[model samples]
Target: MNFQINKDVLLNNLIVAQKALSNKTPNPALQGIKIEVFKDHLVIITSNSDIAIKLNVKDSSLDVKEEGSALIPGKYFIEIIRKLDALKCNLSIVADNMLRIEADRSDITLNMMDLEDYPELEFSEKIKSVKVNVRTLKTIIRQTAFATSSIENRPILTGVNFKIDANKLTAIATDSYRLSQKEIELQDTYEPMDIIIPGRSLEELTKILENNNEVVELHFDNSKILFKYGNIKFQSRLLEGNYPETSRLIPTELPIRIKFNKDSLATAIERASLLSSRDGNNAIVKLSVRPDNVIEITSNSPEIGKVLEEVYPVDQIVGSPIKIAFSSKYMMDALKIFNSTEITVNFTGEIRPFIIKGEYDPEMLQLILPVRTE
Candidate 1:
């Protein structure tokens, strides 16, 4: 393949593709990126069986002298681009299917794999497309992805469950102890789509998004999901199995309602967790509300002593004073996604799950299972 591409575009695409290329794979082709130079565009693809990425740079961004394709080792090829100092780069196919990458005064020829040997990714353009604002997508991932179970043994729990119906779109993730669910209305009509997207894939997608205002395109078939944005396309294998029905798990009402400054509560919990780690278990934060809207947060460890943190509430509690203990780590995770000044923490009882939601934002809710303390 002989083509001249803008250095910045080529490098950016290469960098993103490199993230999906894993060297530990038994299949050698999995470690390489397939570069196909068509009549008017250059396509770069890489996959590790679970996730695949494709980047297309049109002829408008490149000056093509010839057309061909090759599979080159993703790591070394990316290194070549990184070391090159030029505004544009040239890639050529010579004898023996060898590939040459040239930039400025430095050029390197690397052996290429046969294009036919590379695995084919069947993308489904026919599947119903679910469009979401990039900002909302990012927010959903941030608020929930962190709670996804990291253990590979339970693959289903390692993904964020996405449910789309005619009216609302909900994304939920949980590690059993805590769960986060975010819901938003769909502005346009779309067929119902229920699927589990792996947390790792969503994390990568979140990082790769350039702007929040851009609309992200989501396409799903029975087995895979394709996320298309700008010049990049990301495909992730869908996790199989019916995601547990979580709607019934969320409480309908809470007897105790406490609203506190989001920043102040987050800071207090962070400071308390530092000293309360007596064992490997995270620190426990206890919350109680007084009649005058004074909410107190306390943390205690047998060896590390105890701390008392007090903050004023936006609203007063009408029910009996409720005492509840929760993992400081879990509370902090839920607080990070709340950008609002005041956040509501609702509780039914000491042992029941508590929920965090914004004053005006009912579309998002974070639930944390309380820790039993003697």
Candidate 2:
């Protein structure tokens, strides 16, 4: 295979394909980026055990002399191309499974991996696929993927559950202590489907998606899911097991709802958590609505000191006065994701899970289970 292309164009696509390149896998082939040179375009594929990314490069700067395929070491290839000072880069297969890289006044040779060892990844898109705006897909992943459980004991909880019914698409993630859910309307819909996608995979996918009106077609089977963008295909393995029913967990009768400025609440929690020592669990902070309707955020540490921050609600507090203690980090995580200036924290009780919602962000809610402290 021989090709020459604009350095920037080649590097940009390679960087995206590098997301799926595995570093610690048993199969060394997984660490290489498979490059397929065609008559007019180039195909780049990278994969691990969980996620895979394929990119089709058809740029004006591309000059293909021959058509073939090679598995180049992903890390070294990307680094060499990135550091190249030339505007155009030339890559071709040399003798004895070695790849030669030539740029402005630079020469490099890299050992290519055996293509036979790389797993065959099928990125075929089904006729029945769901279309979602790039920005919307990115928003849902950003809002929900963080709540996925990091613990591997319950492997299913480490993924975001994606469910489609008609034109509505819902993404939900939970770590047992906190849950994040976002819902958006799709432009077109087909069959009903539900799948759990690893949170780590979704996070990696979002990094490649640009915020725009471009549509992403989603194709899925029982075992895996594929996301097709303009010229890129991202595929991830699905988790096996049923996700816990979480609709009932969000309290419907939230009698105590208080609206607060999202920034103010976030900063208040940050200040309160500052006094908490990290030797134990996450700092547990108390949020209380005083009789005077002032919101007070307090954190106490016996070995250190205490912090109290008072904030005014955006509007009058509803229902009776209440105080709830929860992990400061969880509340901060929920508050920072809101796009709205104002947010409401709704509660069913002090011990039960309370939800945070924003008026500007419709069909999305963040639920955090309160921490109990005597």
Structural similarity to truth (TM-score) of each candidate: 0.93, 0.97
Candidate 1 has an lDDT of 0.84
What is residue 129's positional error in candidate 2, in angstroms?
Answer: 0.5
List runs of model 1 lying over 4 Å from the truth: 59-61, 114-116, 278-281, 290-293
Q: Candidate 1 residues 87-127, lDDT tens each?
A: 89888998888888888887789888777778887655655
lDDT, each prediction? 0.84, 0.92
The local lDDT score (0 to 100) that residue 285 gets in candidate 2 is: 88
lDDT of 2 by residue, 74-125 (tens): 8989999999999998999999999999998999899899999888889878
In terms of lDDT, the poorest run of 10 residues in model 2 is 275-284
- Which ten residues in a row are the worst by lDDT in model 1? 274-283
Off by over 4 Å in 2: 277-280
Error of 1 at 152 (Å): 2.3
